[model samples]
Target: MRVKKQKRNRRTVKFFSACFGFREPFKVICDGTFIHHLLAHRLLPADDALAKLLGARVTLFSSRCITAELKSLGQSHSESLEASLQLIPASCDHEKRVNAAACIESIIAEGNGKHFFVATQDIELRRRLREVPSVPVIYGLKNSLLIEQPSTAQREFVKCSEEKRLHASVSEIQILRKEVNETDQGRDSFDPDQSSRTRTLKRSLDSTEKSKFKRKRAKGPNPLSCKKKKSKEVSIPSPNKEGSVPAKKRKRTRKKKDSGLEQGSGS
Candidate 1:
């Protein structure tokens, strides 16, 4: 089924200034492309969530890529992103580094001595904002806001904290599938997590075994492991085995549906 398009109207700094910062009525520049993106796809800075975070007088711009992504997200989503975009198209063609620097400079210039803030999830923008030796600005997302000079250390700390929290939440959410000893309140607290679990090297393994072992509990892609995906072994029924079906085909019925239940009866 085709989804219906939803449209949102243009917003300004006057609307959300007080929503994110310590004070109200601040001059803020939002990344419309970012908004388009958050709304068009998945990730943080959720569309409706971010909208409620901004004010009416807000100015918005987007990276050429983000703008393209939004406009191409199709008419409905594009309209949603355009509501707060201020529709200022940013130049990202050629000289990527230069254009990015100029974009931030232009935003700062526009602020012109009043309290101005730049809101984005872009790392490079965050870096440039931190490196510049001038006015104070704030960085934010939905519901939470912070002001800083875009220091890597600060960013790293924030990133680590978020990841740690997500890991804990994920573990707590799945805790019931494994442990029976955990109390309901203990489960609710979300203390120790699988992410927090680290292993000590008890003994050195032989190279052949280490290289051949296919099961790994680590998260994400990692190099240096001398391992290749092993082709699935075909399990055959033993001649002496009784009552076991062949490893391949077993029960057969048509009109298969999902894990919930079969809608139609079968012979």
Candidate 2:
């Protein structure tokens, strides 16, 4: 799908001196070419011209990468490069250095709020810096220093870049949170003591068996049930070696004995 380009509010044409902190010192990031040009053209006092034009003090900054470039530029310019290096009070020394263009761009991008200016005559470098919003460029034009203000499109580009950066950061945070939750679940599910768990299970089983045995022992035979079984056995006939008396004979003997005992008690 083709998306429409949204327009932003057009900022008024305001000079550098009109902005907030316009009077504050602006940092100028220099490259090897700019330094060599400054030395060759005898433009050491160009900083004063820039300050006067922007209505602020100009502080020069460079990186180790630019210094390396100047060194490679050779023995003829070494003295001039040394002199220029003495003038710069600050530098960004990265362990893994890149070209002067990339280093300057990164330093400016990191300085989100601070005012910055790029001093270079490289056409490609100027074009790249122009893509960044609100950054001023200083270059030697017709043997004179000139400054270029950023366009509205550049500012909009910067806004969109920042939004994309913020969205990526939020997604990274969510991914990290999910990873942490999964790690916690793995830790909780782990059983650190296998032997202890097995022992506990055996102990529980033994206790259950003992409880069942005790319940069975507590339920004893009933006395009435035992007496009823003995009476039923005596009423049934028992066979002897010669002959067993019938159940009726046993009952007659028992009756006679009971009657005799009752008569004696009455007398």
Candidate 3:
């Protein structure tokens, strides 16, 4: 298949898997027309062709009603009947044989809880299947097989379900509020004595914690900013013997020779 076609098929498969709970080894229900188309187009071995188109392993299925309807078409559709017989038979719970389209629709029902992918060439059957949520339809286009994109109904259904999940309804909100109020009332009606004891304990614990971590007082002036005090040095005299005299003072005498020299000059 071309890359673009393969990518589109993968995206469709992913959407079904994520939103509709489709898993690996996908289940497919083959109707009479699809089987006939496969034989007519030389696309024999329905399982492999479907597996390749789906990008996963697939188990081909056919209901008893589909096989019976194909048989009723006579030997012209012998090969298609043989191909349909080879597939696993799905239970339609119908005693009487029905049209292939109706049989397939019955199998899919409302939600397609079986997660069956319907492979058919009938345009009307495909249209009907699209209206039902979570049913993926596969159709053959000439030599290539194609999976249809999610239909409007399927997309709208997914959108609505997602909205419901994301936003609670008024009734749901009221139920939640009622639960919360009930829990609150239960708490308020609990033992009052124990509650008072708990409150007092909490207060005492807070006070003790506060006292344990006392706030520091503003510090005194920084020692680095204070002036250093000057130290006084005291001089002590050396001790002398008790009888020893203290140091005496020495006096200088003036000479009379100057006066004598003056008298001699005068004479």
Best candidate (score: lDDT): 3
**All candidates: CA RMSD (Å):** 32.6, 24.7, 12.0
In model 3, which regions exceed 4 Å deviation?
A: 169-171, 184-267
Could you give me the TM-score of model 1 versus the true structure?
0.29
Q: What would the TM-scores of all predictions be?
A: 0.29, 0.48, 0.70
In model 1, what is the error at residue 189, expressed in angstroms?
Answer: 89
Which candidate has the top score in TM-score? 3
Ranking by lDDT: 3, 2, 1
* Total clashes for model 1: 15
Every candidate's lDDT = 0.47, 0.66, 0.90
Please give the TM-score that candidate 2 achieves against the real structure. 0.48
Cα error, residue 241 of model 3, in Å, equals 29
Off by over 4 Å in 2: 1-23, 89-93, 155-267
**Ten-residue segment with the worst summed lDDT in candidate 2?**
1-10
Give the alpha carbon lDDT tens digit for every residue of 92-154 in model 2: 657786788877776777433566677888889888777666666777754456566656656
lDDT of 2 at 256: 43
Which prediction has more favorable TM-score, 2 or 3?
3
TM-score quality measure for candidate 3 = 0.70
